[model samples]
Target: EAKEYAIYIGKMGKVGLMILLVTITSVVCQKSRDWHVGVDTVNPSGTVVHGHANIPLHRGDDGNLNANVHGSRVFGGPYNREQTVGGGLQYEHNSGLHGGLDATNMRGYGTRYSATVGGSRRLGPGTFSIDGGASRLPGSSRTEGNVWATYSVP
Candidate 1:
């Protein structure tokens, strides 16, 4: 019957659309996973083509993970380009303590790596936090840490 045919077609269309969406998303993710993109095209073309994304692929009670990619073309064209791709993972304990590490590599630069460990505790009227870590850049390295306390006034 015509009615039956229409219903079948509708279901097929829905499935096709879903497949297309998922495929596009996966392709985009894969491309960005290895390239970082950036763009600033504010001109007569009215096309500001810039791409930078941070995708959180997993998360659970104990921790979460993310993927980051950044790329940028020349101001008006594609002659000059740059990209950076990396990811980060972090975990938190029930006691309000956490730690994480991040790493990335750029097109022309060497690998950059960093690690951090921090803890936060809630006090009577404020919250206190301490974080310490080190970073290794292309040609140098540095250590950094911070302690912060925050309170709100009524």
Candidate 2:
């Protein structure tokens, strides 16, 4: 019947429209992701060498998530034979928000843990921002925290 054919056509049209919308959304919301690596020698003799790498877990149009690991060693200095290893996760959002959590361990000293969060927003004719962080060292019973704020106009 003509009524049955018209119903089928209407269903097909909706399916096609959904497919087109999905395609457009995929193209517009593409993500950016990459890996980064670096090495640095502080002195000419290369007594201190630091190496680091950053890997992207999720990088999208509105935010980014990354994991980073780093290590440093003193080859031939007063801190010779000393080394440190650290790793952390960093997140940033297009909505003026960011945060990080990290842990580091030194050869002689114990491990240190830290976390930080910050955000910024447009207030009046300028931008207001505030950042706060807390850290704790190994064998310490107390945690230390600090906070800072700023307002800027362009």
Candidate 3:
């Protein structure tokens, strides 16, 4: 029957399109590297380096494809103090799926590792985000979370 044939062709077409999209996304993620650098002053002085990749996986044109890897070195200034090294991965999809893992050294203290999951959506002139995760540090482990909003006025 023509109806059956058409249905079969439609299913195949969808499958083929999905395969193509996945291949293209893999290639783009492999090739794209947008590097960024910054300084953090929360504890003495620290250097932060971040690299990002964009994948075309957004349903809305206003959203972004984000994947980032970052590292930081915190050193005491003008005095000898605890020095630490930290690194993490940050990923956020336009479809509101976000999560990452982070690890850090605490000088004389043991290392800490944590994982976070969160979601964000556009709010009035800003974005609202909430996330929670647990950290394993030295002799103990703890969990925490917070709700935050950011706004950029153009």
User: Best TM-score goes to which candidate?
Assistant: 2
TM-score (all chains, Cα) for each model = 0.50, 0.63, 0.46
Can you write out model 3's per-residue Cα lDDT over 39-130, one digit (the tens) per residue? 34443542222222333334354444444433333323443234455666666676666777777776677777888887776778766666
RMSD of each: 12.0, 19.8, 18.1
**Clashes per prediction?**
7, 0, 0
- In candidate 2 the C-alpha lDDT for residue 58 amounts to 86
What do the candidate models score in CA lDDT, each in turn? 0.54, 0.69, 0.51
lDDT of 1: 0.54
Arranged by lDDT, best first: 2, 1, 3
Tens digit of per-residue lDDT, candidate 2, span 1-154: 2223323444354344334434443443345223222333455443444555566788799999988776665544356557788999999898989899999998888999999999989999999999999999888988999999999999
Identify the runs in model 2 with alpha carbons over 4 angstroms from their true place.
Answer: 1-46, 122-128, 150-154
- Pairs of residues at least 3 apart in sequence or in different chains that clash in candidate 2: none
Residue 33, model 2, lDDT: 25
Q: Write the per-residue lDDT of candidate 1 for residues 8-127, one digit (tens) a residue.
A: 444354344334434544567764443333224445432222344557666677665555543322222343334455666666665767777887776578778888777877776766
